[model samples]
Target: MPVVFFAEGSAAMGPEARAVVARAAERARAWPGVPVVVRGLAATDGSAGFGRALSEARARNVADALVAAGVSPDRIRVQPRGPVPYEAMQVESRRVEIAIGG
Candidate 1:
């Protein structure tokens, strides 16, 4: 499970996120013909609509980053998940998880 953490209300990828994306892309390149599924998740902040939009945007941002890192666009699938309540470490909820599969 490759995860990228994001700041509150932000879709931009920081240094750490970039590093993670780079690593994922490298792995993707290593395993030829495998499709990678990147799911973006965001914490609920009262509004479901807003949360969904944010999550989608975050997911797309990560997908774009991965593509820019040399991963084939066709090999990446972006799935944005709606806000999920987090009782502990809510900040950790603001993230995108990348899973590589065939």
Candidate 2:
């Protein structure tokens, strides 16, 4: 079964988002053979911080980074999250279901 990791964090905008995307892609690419997807979400109340997140503009940043690191994009999906936990708290974490192998 493919593994999909949901990585959530408080990214305000700019390099922060790019950095997170890079990290997620690195982790995803680490899983050999088994397809891996790293979904990154950033939550903010629309401010300068909003500029710090890639979750708003592009989701494939993670996937693109993964491909650059040698992972196949065909096996990955990067999704944007409009609302996510840990925007204010920055420490909150959650896990949900992921149905793989459709």
**Local error of candidate 2 at 14, Å?**
9.2
The TM-score values for the models, in the order shown, are: 0.91, 0.45
Highest lDDT against the true fold, candidate: 1
Model 2 segments more than 4 A misplaced: 1-32, 47-53, 56-58, 85-88, 91-102
Question: What would the per-residue lDDT of candidate 2 be over residues 1-102, giving only the tens digit for each residue?
Answer: 222233444232255445555565555556555655444444444544552354533345445555776666677654555445445534222221111221
lDDT, each prediction: 0.86, 0.44
Candidate 1 Cα lDDT to native: 0.86
Question: Cα lDDT of model 2 overall?
Answer: 0.44
Best-fitting candidate, scored by TM-score: 1
Candidate 1 residue spans exceeding 4 A from truth: 86-89
**1-102 in candidate 1: lDDT tens per residue?**
789999988889999999999998899889879999989888875787877888899989989998898889999898988677755447887999999893
Q: How accurate locally is residue 54 in candidate 1, as Cα lDDT from 0 to 100?
A: 83
